[model samples]
Structure formats: structure tokens, C-alpha cells
Target: MVAVRLSADSNGVLETPRDGDRMSAISRRALLTTTAGAAAGLAVAGCGAAGGGKQGAPRAQRTGEHSGASGARAPAKTVRLIGDGSTADTGPQPNQPVVDRLEPGQTPPQFVVFSWDGAGEVGNGLFPRFRKLADDHGATMTFNLSGLYLLPEDKKLMYAPPNGPLGASDIGYLSDEHIRMTLDNLRQAWTAGHEIATHFNGHFCAGSGSVSRWTPADWKSEIDQAVAFVTQWKTNTGWYDEEPLPFDYAKNLIGSRTPCLLGQDNLLPTAAAIGWRYDTSNPGGDQIWPSKRMGVWDYPLQLIPFPGHSFEVLSMDYNMLANQSHAATSSDPRNYPGWRSQATASYIAGFQRAYETNRAPFFIGNHFEEWNGGIYMDAVEETLKHIAAQGYKDVRMVSFQQLTDWLDAQDPALLDKLRTLEVGEQPPGGWKEFLGQVPASTATGGAGEGAAPAVTATT
Candidate 1:
């Protein structure tokens, strides 16, 4: 039987499982303390100040992945310093002024809104419009395409027949025609610069119930197959060179939102072992929390509990919106136009509140197939526009893997700042703290256009 465990800390409630389980809980406080100690140690070592006399000036270079289209290498000037005088290392070089400053208790930098449940009965014929909406909002969404949708000929055969190794009914079965259409649609989206990741070949229910039931090898094959299919499609469509298939260019089929968000505890650790860096399956509902596992990040879909049945309420709204949009006419007042106006208003209001309060990256989660077509489409576009107007600049629309890469590339200084704050420290009851700190600007040597002086301190 699958076991689950929930724990609370300064960030929010975190659900993980027992040892040896797929998911693990991390204490924000513990993480901060650990990070702080490490930073302090590094600072002392770098300066050679711990032993007595000063050492040769430590190297000025910082290391991490660059944020660019070609994955080309670029120098990062800002580095995270730890210890008593870490901040002293940073100062305004000759001509430059610090434009942005981060104080203690600030929320972490950047917010992301990710969508799941793309492909299959719900997502078929709906993605084109959805893609448009995502584009309009300047938001990056991950379409966790179900693998069953990739098989065209014997679509039903993709699902494990009853009495097969995976006992329960297949949750994401789709018609062969629908599968091919969805594949084509996804290719279009990818070419247009959207992220397409995996939701799993069998969905969440596929590997639920017991670990003994599914081996590591089974899990690997399931994930590998999805990666292989997408990679092959890119090649077939001439997206990559035909002669020497760009295996390196293969998208890091890394993001996953479990079917039903059910088997997250089981899926997370398994994913990590197989090289995934992020999972968006947990349903914390509006609150953002870092994952316990260090390498992977958890972008939980925020769901707020209401007086009435919450899921039922959301489901009803989804269906209503879907139907209204699907049947909407250009002139219908209570149809597409009405839903767009209302949803946009709500999304803007919510986003503003989150931004002002420094609790952002607002997540609006829904199955691709659940809504009335026109209404859903309209809501998506309006929401996108509203967000853009709200001054959310440089929003990175990326896949789950890209998110992880971004996180991995975080300026050690940013992480150091979070570490110094002491993970679980909360501001006074009435005060709102901004935890999102922007990285220090990189330094360009030899005085080029917009170049600043190079200042290095030895203490």
C-alpha cells in the first residue's frame, strides 16, 4: 500500500512519505541552517581568513548554466558569498548604481504558472486555443502530454488490458486519430516556442498502490519511452538535423504532473533517480514551497479550500466555462465575452493581491478537457493579457526541466540570501516580506559600452 505523510514548516504544509518512499519532506529551517553554515565555511576558506593571514585573492568567477537560446556559455559576475563579511564583497563599481535591492524576508524571485493534463480526451482539439492564450499572457505553461496519446494505430492497446501488471483502469486512454492530432498539435506548439513535457504513459494511476508492483526498470522504461517519442517526432519533422540526430538537443522531458496528483509521493523520488529536476503534482493550493529533495523543485498547484465541496466547485466552474466558450458566438453577451471579462477580472485581482503581498506565481490548474471550449479559451487569453499589464517583466515561459535548470543556475548569492534569512523566519503578524531577490549584475571587464569598474575586496 502507498503511504503518505504531511508536515508543516514556515513555508507551508509539505507532504512526503516514509524513508525509502518516493517523496521526502524537507524542513525549510533545517535547510537554511545548513546552507548558512556552508556559506560561512566557504567564505572563511576563500579569504584564507580562518587560519590567520590573508590568502591570495580568491577567483572572481562564478559558475552555473547560462540562460540563453543556444545554451552557449556566458560569464556570471555575481557570486554568492557567505560568512561575516559576505555582503562586503559586493559594492557599486565606478559608474554603475544598484538599481534593485533585496531586503530580508523578501519572497523568492520569479513566479511561474504551469498547466497540466494536456492530451487525451480532455486536451484534444483544445490546445491550439490554449496555446494562443498562453502566448498572450507571456506565461510559460507545460503541457504534460500523456504518452497514450502518442500511439496512433492501436490506441486502446496502449492501455494495459485488464488483469495486466498495472491493475487499475487506464486513466488517460485516447483514440488513435486523436493521438496523432494531438502529436501534430504539440509539434506546432514546440516549434512556436512552448514547453511540451510528459504526464506519464499510463498517468498517475498506472503505478499507484504498491512499489513492489512496479520495479525501477519499469518506471525507467515508461519515462524513457515518452522522451524517445518526442525526440523522434522532432527529428521526423526536420526540427533537427537528419544525419546525426541531435540527441543532445532532445528536450529534457523532465516535468511531470501525476494523473490525479495521486502518486506524487511515489513518483518524486523515482523521478529524481532517473534525472528529473522538478515535479508539479502536489496540491498546496496557492502557497509556494520548495521541495524537500534538494535537486528537484516542487511547483504545487495552489488550491484554496472553500466552505462547500472545493473540487466539485472547481469542476463545475471548469465545465461551465468550457461549455460557454464552445458554444459562444461573436455577439453573445453571456457567453464567451462575458466569461473572458469575468475570468480576466478575477485573475488580475488575484494576481495583484499575490504580487502586492509578495505571494505570487499564482497557479490556475484545470484539466485540458474539462471546460467549455470557448469560455476556457477566452479566459486563458484575457488572463494572459492582464498579467502582462501588471508589470511582470522577464517572465520565463519554460518547461519543467527548464525551470529546474533555472533553479540550478540560481546565483549562489540569491540562495545565500535565502539561507541567511533563516528558512522558517516569518515577519511580524502585520508585515509582508519580499523574499524574491534579483541576482547582482554581472561585471564586464576592460570598459565596454555600459561597463562598470571591477572592484574586488580581499577581506
Candidate 2:
């Protein structure tokens, strides 16, 4: 048994355990109402809170404790909420949609390429090739830049920090000079109309089990810092030539791919509060705007699991390619031929599957290190040529931010319809489904059985 206490300081909701009890903190805003029943030997706590706002002051703070028949109390788990109010039995009502109308045909879904787990070397190595490929195909792409790249020192810090909440084994090799070069490359991409967006400053896991560990405040801080950092960079660069860069596209500069492809089901409210419209973290089907979370659309990548494999190969190839050892393999130009041909073949098959089906948006993700070898670069170039050969009518390659802006500007009714269109259990048929299931582990790895998938080596 657990005793839970709820209190709201000016900062937010805080929860602490009483004598002998256990509790868990929830992310939504709702007043927790405790219903105690002695006869049933059960105490059900209900949370009833309305939308965010100040309520009447509490008459008295309520506290409860539970013990066994022998009068022996169990250890308690502490949970907290950040608001002022009494605990209630009701949960929060879903946000009402402003427009609830439907259109006839589904909007043609867009293909977006997303990479995960930052590797500055990989980013630096691959961007040129990727840029050329995009140019050849006349398509734009979105790179969910890992927060690891933004670390004050090492570039890998952009993916997961060295000592913070999400850090594990740090493998950053990019120095300040390298980072500046990488940033310059990003600026070039931005100038060329590519999308640069956040992949979580700390690569925070977003699935159900792991997500419960994040407090609302924690979410706010992580996202806020990421947005602030990117905004600051753009602002600084805009003034580089003694002229203000146009701010017309600043707001559209929002897109994210959670580390390890963990879904953001639990972080919707926090994301909404921060004004993000699309997250490419999870892959499943054709593009979908989920009904439960308003305004956000999910575009999943599609690919099939490689032969004799439990998982797909894209992320694995990404990780392997990013590791320096793989770069050494590419030093020999002769060996590049086979690997390049294989990689290009794989990517072409994936892209063609999506394109032939009219899924205009296809996310082809890879880590920066994947392009270290000249062979890998050649493969990437070949893949681009293959995509171009498909003859996409208006292959408007776009960044995640651009997609969000377009969605935001649509009629509210259209937006609602997009959100309500269910893609069934998984994302639409294509590479989106193939790429959506990247593995993520919990903090303790396997510490908690019901816990969400934490960071782990999936491939």
C-alpha cells in the first residue's frame, strides 16, 4: 500500500509519500480525489481536474495512509502534481475540437527522412551527399538534429548528454571546429530549404513505461531548452551579414523524432503546450493525424525487416556506419563497390515502394557516420538518382517545420478531419511501418517489467 500527498507550490504540482504508501506521478492536469473504503480493503484515488486555471483555495490538505491487518504499513511511493486544488474522482476531459468536419479524399501523405542518435562525424560526412541527392531528386528533407549536436563542447551531447538524465555511453568525437563546420553545413541546408528540427535535447524516451518517469516540468524544460538553442543559432546566423534573417519561417522550424523511435503517446499535452505540430519519431502507416491528440500529425517511415532478422536494418546500418570502425572499412575504395551497391539497392527498393503507392512523403533515415566511406557516399548518390527516376510530379522535398506550417494554415475543419482519420493499428502500408519500430529501453534497462522501452541497441 502507498500513501500519496498532492500539493501545488507556485512552481507546479508536487507529490510526496506519507508514512507507508506508494504512488506515481501523472503528466496531465487533474485534481486527485481519494475514495477510501474500509470494507472492501481498497482505496481508489480518482483525479478530477478541468483545463488549466486557478481554483478556490483548499480548505484543508488531505492525507491518507494504509496498513495491513496486523498494523504493519508498507513502504510508500511518492508522486507529485504541479497545481493547486483538491483531489477529485474525475479525469480531465479531452480537448474539444474547434472544427469537426470531414473532407472526401485523404490528403496525399508526404515522405520525410528522419535520422536518430546523433553522430556529428556522420552528419558532417553525409550532409553533402544527402544534399546532392535531394537536389538531384528536386526534393527537400528534414533531419531531426539530435540535441547531442548542441552540447556546449562535444557534438554527441546533442543526442544524449554526458552527465544528465539521458546520458549513457558517450561517443562524441566532434570538436568545436568540427561542430562549427557541421553548423555551417546545417546553415547551408537551411538556406537550400531543408528542415532542421529537434530530436529531444536529451533523447528522452517517450513510450508508455519510460514516459511516466518524466514530470511535466521536466518535459517543459527539455523542450524549452531545445527550442531556445535552435532559435538562438538561427538568430545569430541571421545577423551574420549585418542583416536580419527573415523570421517568416521561424515558427515552422518545429519537428522532432524521439530517440530510439519511441512513440510520443504520453508527451502529447506537453508537445501541444509547446506548439509542435508533427513528430516523426514513430513509424507505422500512411501519414495520420491522431484523434486523441489534436493538431499533431504522425508520419511514419516504411521498410521491411531484413532477411533472418527480428528488427529492421536502417537504424542498425545507421549505427554501424556511424561507428568509426565502419569508416575504416570504407578507406579501401575497392570494398566500397559492393557495400555501395547493396545500400543503394536497399534504399531504392524502399523509396520505390512508397512512391509507386503515391505516398509522396517517404522518410529515409540514416546517421551521419553512414556516409563516411566514399562507397557509402556513392550509394547515397545512386539512391537519389533512383528516386529521381520515379518521376514524382511535384516532388516538393520539405522539412518537418514546413509540413507543420502547411498543416497549421489549413481550415480548422480540415485539420480536425485529418486528426480524426484513423490509420488503424499501424501506420499506412509502406516504409513508414518498416521504420517505425526502432527499439528503446528504460533507464534501468530491464529494471521494471511494465516500464517503457528504454534506450537500447535494437539492431
Candidate 3:
């Protein structure tokens, strides 16, 4: 029940002013407010903050089974438990794509981050379905797990969210069966190299004492609750038969998407204090290289081409839904085809805008929902296929964590240069001259210059 702020048109997309002016969804004043249910922070939700805070990406270690290019199977890594035997370090993240720094003359790859809010595997099957989709495409994504999704309704009292009464949540706990399903999916996701991030617990929005009202102390409470739920799932669920998650939540969790994209001003500090690496709660930002806010990466939702509209919408399904159907989660049957097309086109246009111009990492957000006849889901799958299509070299469907690793490895000056390009603007004098480096032998033409090979960094 996070306030679907601005009552979206199709489902979760906010109803923007008819004039189509962008950037009005969230206000600066709202973010500065210590008030309880208003909106704040406008990069559009990420998946962020400033300063060179102490957080760094965990060093890579070998994990699971792997095969050499020569086709010989590598020995499996031993699983080492971290804490309470709830999570284990099996080694380099299995199936995690190689992430390396961009060379002096390399053009940044078109990194598209496909992330979800309240990620859970339920009867809908969308979770497993997309997991297969990612594997099919050799892509990775971030799953913003809503903590309560791992908590059964019977264990609701265990949550105790910030500011609200005990066990109080706008969106209540899931069924025990669903919780187990969520657990299964979460474990599989990590093993497959997908990132597990947060959407916090209790999902407060305006009128329900939304998180927007909470202070850093309030946010810490929320963060602690979220962490406890993931790390203590075995203890909470008491499902001894089930194996624990494959990674340490305390070590693994580094990013989040605040509910409704609210309360980031406070959330950033809380994130930094806990050594988190990023926050994705900004409401609206352009296609540009991300920088640190509050000392961590602020990977906010971007404002991208909205196809027919003059104002670009946040790259999120809810915004698309609002623009098409005015907050109607279920639309007229007749509108399905057009809505799907519009949604698909928006995603492609947004991707192309960055692909052609700035090469800023695209942060696309979605929920595991069956809204608007499931048109958004169809649109995302189609868009991903298009991104991975032939001739699209250097394109990756990455998780926010993977994207951050790659970004952190780059030179600050090079990223600053990237931020100079406008929408659809190509580099002047081409890639080699612009970046002052030579292309690899395997890479053909100008595109090869920025396509650096992947690297592994071990602690």
C-alpha cells in the first residue's frame, strides 16, 4: 500500500500534468521535509549517494561449478559459512558476468539495469519466468526484495516497522507458502548472479505514515528490520529442511529502492552509515553518468523518451501505465495491443536515446505484477530481446551491483566526459579520437574502441 503517488494512469505510473512538463512528480521541498507522508528526492527511484564513503564492492572469489573455454569442468568451490550458518560464501559469484573498467579510449557499453520492486516469486510465475528470460539472454538483474515477502503472515509481529504500530504495514505479509517460494527464488537468483537489493519493509506511503516522514534514525530501524528478515529467514521460518540463501545478506546487500521513491534525503545517510554502496530512490534524472551522493552511488530512475510525448517519463512501468490508462491497473481489453506497443516503444526509444548519445547506464524499474493485461511484461521481454539483438555489441542487461562494479573501476575524468553528451548526440570526431585509445583486434570498426574485455577482481 505504498502510496502509488499521483494515481498512475495504467497502474503505477503517476498522473503527470496534462501539459506534459517533466520533473514535477517529486519536489525539492518535499525531500527536505521531515514530514511524514510527502514525496522527496527526484532521480526517480534507482536502484545512490555522495562522498567517498568507505563502502567498496566485495572482492570476487570462485564459486559453484564452472567450465573452462577448453570445455574442461573446473572443480567446485567449497561453501564457507559466514554467520549463524544462515548464508554461505561458495565463491566468485556463479554466472556473474565479467565486469571491468573502461580503457582510455573505450566507449561505455550500453548498460541497461532491469530491476524489480517487491521482488517475490508467487503463484503468478512472473518471477521464475523472467529468471529464465535472463538466463536465456545471458543477462543479469536486481531483485528489490520486499522483506516481508520472506515473512509469513503468522510472523507479522516480527517485523515491527519504523514509526508504525507493531506489525503494521501498508502491504501485509505474504502466505507461508509464498514465503517459501520467495525463499526458493531468492536463493536461485543469487546462485545465478542476480543481485538481491531492498524495497524496505512495511512499504509506508502518505496517509499511512509513509517513510517520507521518517528521519535517519527511523530509516535505520527500517533497514535493520529488512536486514533481520533476510539474514534470519531460517530462524524466522524454522524451515530446517530448506537450505539457506547462498550469500551473506550483510555483505551482499548494498543498494535499495525506497517505497514510492520517497524519503531518500534521510535514506541516503542511513545507507552510508551502514556502508551501503547505493540508493535508487530519486524520482527523475536525465540520461547521464551516475555520481556519488551521500558517498555512495545514486542510481536513480532516469527520465527517458516516452515515444509520442514531449516530456519523457521515468523508465518505470507505473509511469507508463499512468500515461496510458490513468492509474487503471486493468485496462479495457481493446487497449492491450496499443498499450503493449506503446510500452515497448518507450523502452526501446529510451534505450536508443542513451545508446546513441551519452551511454549513460539505463535504470529500468518494474514490479512483479500482472497489470494492464500483462502488457508491461511483454514489453520488457521484447525490449530486452531488441537490446541483445545482433549488431548491438557491448550491451548488457546488468544488475545494479554489476553496473556499480564496472563504474567504480573507470576513471573519473572519462565519466565526466561522458556526462557532456546530450540526448542522441554522438561523440565528436568518433570514438578512437574522442577517447584517445586503439580498438581491440577482435572488435571491428569504431565500436571496438570502447568495448573493453571483462576483468575479475579478487580480494
Candidate 4:
């Protein structure tokens, strides 16, 4: 178990109530309270520390040794640098699953997305720990990188957050050493087939300067800055020794998860206008099939069954901690054993319900935190292994970008039919009969003369 340093709030207040100061910057609403009955209150999953520590010297260049998106190594090719050589064009991404349209009556693959927030590596080893885990299981996940993590704290004024003064930030900036480590992890993550999406910057979640109040124009500004920090790190930092990132950020970033799960209502328009493919910022969503908002796929944090409780909890590590110990990052030692088991069970139960019934994709969000003695991290590791044991043929662990590719390639009618199945509700009759009625022309890659059939299933 690792311990993370708590970042000061936007106002520079450091409230250290526990060993790690877990919620030092968490908003009031983020202090979620769940009860014993079926009336548990929903709380937002707050972002964790952006702390960094010594992790070893980062590799100076990309070897391109990792396999491609389809699990096959791409042919050796020269890398063409972009901009000031902060990033490069590395052909197709590696470790990506080949997206194919599901044949009629075929069982849809159970998709599980394990995503990380504030994807910073602060010497705690959480970042590389999970990357190794994914490698062991042949799984790929998304790392929602915060742009501020790359910007040196000394260059804080470079960022002009909307509704706030110059150099203002809620989450602390990583040290130069940590920043180098972050760059290294990002480079390796991309080449290993994991997505490097945005988690925005500043992490402002409270007061007038909070992201929740930001307008679409404000969101556009924030997104632009986030991209700049990533694509032009060389120009900003003046560091020429390190290698550029493997992929082009401008084209690679197709999705994001807003800070504190706030401002999505306004962020959606800017996301769609910018041609983003998906958004996972919505809160307290049911365990049902996802729909689109502003023409972009909406993959929200779902309400999964909370073990030993009447109500459910959000499919996130922070939410589990909130319910278990009232948001305390460190709690009574006696409760650790039971809490770990409960958290593990919660994730597994959620996955089983969807995999056995509706086949809805499972989205789990976490931070590189050691909250509650790092039990949440342990639970997440266990959950990943549990699902991986189900065999890769049917249970495919993927990134949000990979999942979106599959979704876009599918038959819309078939997807609509799948959406009809509610949480824990199986397909009417069976898989063979329920999907057998979909017309062939509407099937993926099918181009026939027959018209697509209307939805006859109960909504």
C-alpha cells in the first residue's frame, strides 16, 4: 500500500485530518453519505493527488517493441516528429483489439473499461503497477491524464484557467522529476495500446471559479490549453533530452472525464463541436446501456450493487471509500479486511449482473491514490483478475476509445435493442431468439436492399 500526499485546495488551504490528507481539496458535495437502507446518497468521485516521486530514469526513446491494437507488433518504421518534437506520428496504436460488427444472433462481447484519473506517477509506483497488471492479463485500459501534471509548477502562470486568475490551480503541480516520470509513463502507455485521454486542468470544483459554472466557451478554452500543454511541452519546458510522446495528442484525444464529474452539461457541446467521440463525466447513472448526448457517446459512472447494503454505489474507488468510512482516506485498522472484501465484491457483482444479463459495458474509474490503506487499489486489482479469468474470447478488457470504435461499427438497431434490456434483466427469450429478428442489412458490414426493421421489443 502506498501513501499519497494531499494537495492544497484552490484557496491554498491544507486540511490534513488523516495520515494522507485524502480529501484535502474535495468539495462539500463530494462528502457523500450512504445509509443502511436503500436510500444511499450519491457522492461525486473526487480526483486524487498529483504527487510525484523518484521512479528511476525514464527511457530516452521509444523502442516500438509493444504490439499493435490487434495484439500484433507493427512493422519496424521510423518515427516522424511533430511540432518541437514533443510528440510524434507512430503509425497505428499497438495492443488495440480489431473492432468487428457482431454477426446476427452473436453474443456481444462483455466490455470492461478500467480507467485511471490524474494519471500521474509520483514515485508511489501506482501508475506502473497497474500497467504491469494489464500486461500480465493482456488487457488494455484508459489513463485520463491531467494536463497540469505535465506543466512545471514554476511555470504555473502559463496556465490561465477560466473564471480564475493567472497561475491558479486546485490540484498541486508535480515536481520536475515527477513530470519526467509522467512523460515516461505516458509514452509507454500509448505504445502499449492504452489511451491517453484528458482529465482537463486546474480541477476547480468549488466556489465561483468552479468548473461546474463554466460555459461552453470556457470549456473550449480549457480544452485548448490542455492540448497545448501536451503537444508543446518541449517549447514550454525547453527540455530537449527526453523523447516525444508516441502519438499525436490533437488526433489521439477523442474523449474526456470532467473534473469532479461536474460541468458535463456545458462541456458536452464543446466536446461534440471539437469532434470528440465519447464523454464519461455524468454521475449517478443507472447500470443501463449508454446513450448519446450532443451526438457523442455518454458513458457515465454507473450505480452498481454495494455489497451488504440496500442501495448501490457509483462504480468508482472514491465512492466506495465514501460509503465505507465516510470519505476518510485512512480509517480504523480493524475495518480494512471487511472493507476490502466488500469493495471487491461490489465490482464483481456489478460486472456479473451486466455480463450475464444486459451485456452493457462496465466503466470503473479510479485515481492513483493509496486511500484507505490502498484497499481500493487491491480491490480493483482483484476485480480485474476476476474478470480476466472469464477468458479473453468473450470478456474483453478495453479502453474507452477502443470501445467507442466497436460501438460506432455496430448496427444501430442492434444497439437500440440491447439498450431495451434494463439492469439485471436478460434478453427476452434468449440471445439466439432476441437478436435473430434483426435484419441482415442492418447488421454491421451488411449492405442489402431490405429496409431496416423497426424496434418491436419493449422499451
Candidate with best TM-score: 4
The TM-score obtained by model 3 is 0.80
Candidate 2 structure quality by residue, lDDT tens digits, 289-394: 4222444556554432222223333322332232212223234556555556555665665555544444434555544432335454465556666655756653
Question: What order do candidates take by TM-score, descending?
Answer: 4, 3, 1, 2
Q: Tell me the RMSD of model 3 versus the true structure.
A: 9.6
lDDT of 3 by residue, 1-459 (tens): 222334433322343122212221221111100111212221123211000000121211122212121011224556676555556776666666555666767777889999888876555667776776777777888888877777767788887777677888655566676676676666667766789998888766654466777899999988888888887777777865556676878788989998767788998888888878778887766778777776777887777777666556678776676567754556698999988998899889889888877788888888776667788889998988888785586887889888877766565566656767766778888765677643323321111122223345632
Sequence-dependent TM-score of model 4: 0.84
> Which ten contiguous residues of candidate 2 have the minimum total lDDT?
48-57
lDDT of all predictions: 0.39, 0.38, 0.66, 0.72
Stretches of model 1 off by over 4 angstroms after superposition: 1-110, 120-125, 153-176, 204-218, 228-251, 292-294, 304-346, 370-377, 394-399, 412-459
> Of 3 and 4, which scores higher on lDDT?
4
Question: What is the full ranking by lDDT, best candidate first?
Answer: 4, 3, 1, 2
Over 1-459, each residue of candidate 4 has an lDDT whose tens digit, in order, gives 111112333311122123222234432112211111111233335443431101121222322222232111335676778889888897776556667777678888899999987787776777777877887777788888889888888899999999999988777677777777788778767767788999888877656777778999999999999999999888878887667887989988999988767788999999988889789887657777777877788898887888777667778887777667866666898999999999999999999999999889999988877767889889999999999787757887889987887777778777777788899999988888888887654343111112122322210
lDDT of 1 at 347: 50
lDDT of 4 at 192: 72
lDDT of 3: 0.66
The residue-by-residue lDDT of candidate 1 on 1-459, one tens digit each, is 111223433332234333344322212111100000111001000000000000121111111111121111212333232222101112111111112333343444445564645443222335555555554544445667655454433323434422245322234334444443454455334433445566655433223432224454555666775555444543223323211111122333666765435445656667777656677766444433343343456676553321212121121123223223321122254454556555555455545555544333455554443223345445555655666665755343344544444444444454443433321233234232333333453432111222223332211
